[model samples]
Target: MTDFTGSMGYCEFQIPFFIEGVRVETSQMLVGTEYHEEAEKIDRETAIVMPLTKTKLQDKKEDLNFVREDIQTSFVQEFDFPECKATLSLFGRADKVVRKKETLIVSDDKHVSNPRRYDVMSEPYVGQLLQVLAYLNSKYYLGESFGGWKEIPCSTKMYQINIVDSKTRSIYKTYEEIITEEHAELFLDYTSKFIKKCLELDSLDHHNSKPKCKACGYFSDCSHALK
Candidate 1:
């Protein structure tokens, strides 16, 4: 159980949210930089749930149409506008890739105790949509061994499989995201600005927002946090 506020590495998922959190935590070098051992326990627990969910999903893959798991992907490309000339290295791993005949469904599992609180169409889980699209847009984010994988599905759609704790309740069920080209393009545009903003960061810049603070692990030490 590693418990600490680690520095941000370039990750392909939830780019904006992670950037914002880092900016806040890094604002006051004196206080925020110190690692809060207790804060990361929740994150560790969350991470632990992933492998368990993946194992369960793996068992049902054939029936659920999952094609692959833990697929590694990386790419370097220049962006448009403010991010121009900057070659960003995007890297990530997709938890599962489901085959739906011709269209490929790239799915990432999000485990929560009370998943009913997060509606797929709401803002809370919107980042999941963005992250999953990154995997799909990068052509399923799979290695060359999956060369037979079709590109059409990659361009067309993706998914997010929300695994809620069924034992906690009677009606808790998993939700799925149906990502489209519009969703992908919107997130890509956001990524462009995200890259530019990240490059421009010198000192930590913090935002005055309540909801973000609630979700931030470093909020207790963040002097600029509203909460």
Candidate 2:
């Protein structure tokens, strides 16, 4: 979903790699993967098992009591939207899921080589936002039994982490926004159309942006890559 939404040619260009079970890995991708693995390990080791009563669970919905619950990080979730026949399912992993006070927060962590590159941007990229929205929507509509709460307010967050220098600037910025059912519907509609177009081999040309092409892991092997 992120690739299809972020880059014009990524989905088409990656098809061969996927078929061959070859992942194009860059240094940045490796670093991000390592960091997430370490974080997940630590979270698992230090996670607390808390017991909740029926009254406390009810209070959680009404915001009557202050409760904090940290869900397992990097847990995979699948969302099935039968209404969109073209692309009936989507899957994503949320970096963080927490219920603080009255709101459920879904966060995605992005590890960047340099944080200064995004200083001009006011918020997260559209693809990043959508990724988190997918997680939020899945949890809201389908995770009542797992999450132990329902009909509560939900929001999405993007944490931009500076991988190069954590002491000076660990977290560069946090982009946040409220997510709703309408947003989820709109996302599903867009994704369905996008998948249908991909199936028809429509607009499979490279974006032709030199910077993007150079940064792409598949640039060395991609036939359509910009020189």
Candidate 3:
């Protein structure tokens, strides 16, 4: 259906290239001295797919043809993963509604701040986010409204949660079917380490990240490029 990769309120880039004059496409070769380096590179990718109907596919194509636009109205949903943990994540635009009008609460901090939670360099949270999404996909599909909230509350707090499974490996079945807890103890340890690693990476990214030019047309002023 509709294919998208988003950073929401962050660096969003799209590359459109013609497939012409290309008979084949392949990934780059990994370079490393140690055998473990090659092994690490093997886990660099995870594949996930969704079921789509003809109508949904057409709608997604229309949304993608010109530009990819994100949903402005925020939504929240509480998730109960396979691990028996109940947690929630926020979705929607930064400029969109923050506190729900009637209820007036910020139930999820991730929704209001709109930062990259699952950093590429982070340890556990990155994989955890993937694992959680994959688990959710197995049980249900993404719905239009916030599944967790009847009305977004007035005050919201932040809490971090991690998801892991040993039965699922990229080398085996697809991501959707693989998010299961086979080795809970080991997965928890690795994922926890990954979380701290990603936090440090986030701090570095914040300091070094640059804003777009002031003269750019897509943005109003350079000062507003998300500091």
Clashes of each: 0, 0, 11
Per-residue alpha-carbon lDDT of model 3 for 1-227, expressed as tens digits?
00011121122221011112212111211111222243334423331223433343224222111011111232233433343433233233211122222222111111111123334433332333433332222222224443422232223212123221222311211111223354344434433333232232222122124443221232332233443
lDDT value, residue 167 of candidate 1: 39
User: lDDT by residue for model 2 over 1-48, one digit each (tens)?
Assistant: 445444422435654554456666788767777777777777767766
Q: TM-score: which candidate is best? A: 2
**What order do candidates take by TM-score, descending?**
2, 1, 3
Estimate the TM-score of every prediction: 0.56, 0.68, 0.19
Give me candidate 2's TM-score against the actual structure: 0.68
The sequence of per-residue lDDT tens digits that candidate 1 reaches over residues 134-215 is 6666633333444522233322354655543433422244455566567767766656655665566323344445776656
> Model 1: runs farther than 4 Å from truth?
1-68, 82-84, 119-124, 140-155, 166-178, 201-208
- Root-mean-square deviation (CA) per prediction: 10.1, 5.6, 19.3
Using lDDT, rank the candidates from best to worst. Answer: 2, 1, 3
Stronger candidate by TM-score (2 vs 3): 2
Q: Give residue 73's lDDT in candidate 2 (0 to 100).
A: 23
